[model samples]
Target: MKLSNEVKFNYPREDIWKALHDPEILKHAIPGCEGLTLQEDGSYDVSMSLGVAAVKGKYNGKVYMTDIEKPNKYLLEAEGSGSPGHVSMKMDCNLEETEEGCLLKWDCDAEIGGKIAGVGSRALGGIAKFMAKKFFDDIKKQLKKGAYTN
Candidate 1:
């Protein structure tokens, strides 16, 4: 599946970039994240427990940030598996500076296999979008509360 979205942030691009990379902030924003550890190799180890309908399960995965352009853009790649199924995604994330703050945009390509894939593409698409929105909203709330992850 492929999905795209843009979120407006009332914070500076630099600040948004920092928040996105901060492990604590990411752990807080990721809907079901149990742990987010930054590895010395610049990758992240993630553990998540999700109870969302047919996709409910505990997942462990590694995420890699590549093609980084500092406070501008980067590629996020992740793959995880659980009792329900397996999922992998590659998302291009961009942060553009705007007059008010920052405009964060992302385009993602994802693949799923096993029981989870049985949920149908349309349903999965909606779920992915919902999860994405929650993630961004959580970040926005943190920024507003001055919860600087770094």
Candidate 2:
């Protein structure tokens, strides 16, 4: 599946970039995310429960950030598994400063296997896109509320 979205945050680009690197901010932004731990070597362990549109399950995943250009762009690769199936996804992200705030552009590709693949691929894409938008909106709100103190 391929997904893309653009969101504008009501903060400076630097602050938004910092929030993106903060585990706490990430945990809060992801729907049903229970916890996020940032390991010393640029790896992250994430625990999350997902019940979006057509799929419901708990996932434990590791994400690695690469091709990072701090405060500007990066690539994220992640994989997770659950009783229903497994998910592997990759995303390329770009951030640009706007007079009002910052504009974020995200492009992603994902694949599902096992039971989750039984759901229609088109339906799955829609569901995943919705979830992604929700996640970004959550992050924007948190930043607006001064939730990321760091």
Candidate 3:
């Protein structure tokens, strides 16, 4: 699957970048995130629980950031497994100053196998898009509030 989105945040690019790298902020912004731990070498370990139309489960995953260009751009790659399936994705994220604050653009490609794929591709795409939108919206709200707690 392929996903793309653009989000406008109420915070400066630097602040948004900081929040993006912060495990605390990520745990809050990500849907169903139970825990996120930062590791050495700019990697992260994450756990989340999610239930789509027909696929429901908890996923434990590892993510790493690479090709970073300071506060401007980076590449993120992540993969996770649940009881019945697993998903792996790679995304490129770019940030820039906008009239409102910061503009973030991301393009992602994902591969899924096992039971989750049994739910059907179209349904999964819809669910993933909804979840991604919600995540970005939450981030925008958090930025507006200066910080998000718990």
Cα error, candidate 3, residue 61 (Å): 0.9
Q: lDDT for every model?
A: 0.92, 0.86, 0.89
| Candidate 2, position 42, lDDT | 83
lDDT tens readout by residue for model 2, 49-123: 877456688889899999999889999999988877888999998999999888999999898897788887887
Question: Which pairs of residues have clashing backbones in candidate 1?
Answer: none
TM-score of each: 0.96, 0.92, 0.94
Question: Ten residues in a row with the worst lDDT in model 1?
Answer: 141-150
| Candidate 3 similarity to native, TM-score | 0.94
Residue range 46-83, candidate 1, lDDT tens digits: 99998656568999999999999998999999999999
Off by over 4 Å in 3: 148-150
Cα lDDT for residue 93, model 3?
98
| Clashing residue pairs found in predicted model 3 | none
Q: Against the true structure, candidate 1 has what lDDT?
A: 0.92
- Give the true-structure RMSD of model 2: 1.8
User: Candidate 2: minimum summed lDDT over ten consecutive residues — where?
Assistant: 141-150
lDDT of 3 by residue, 27-144 (tens): 8999999999998777999999988676789999999999999899999999999986999999999999987678999999999998998988898999999999988887777766
Model 2 alpha-carbon drift over 4 Å, by segment: 52-55, 148-150
Clashing residue pairs for model 2: none
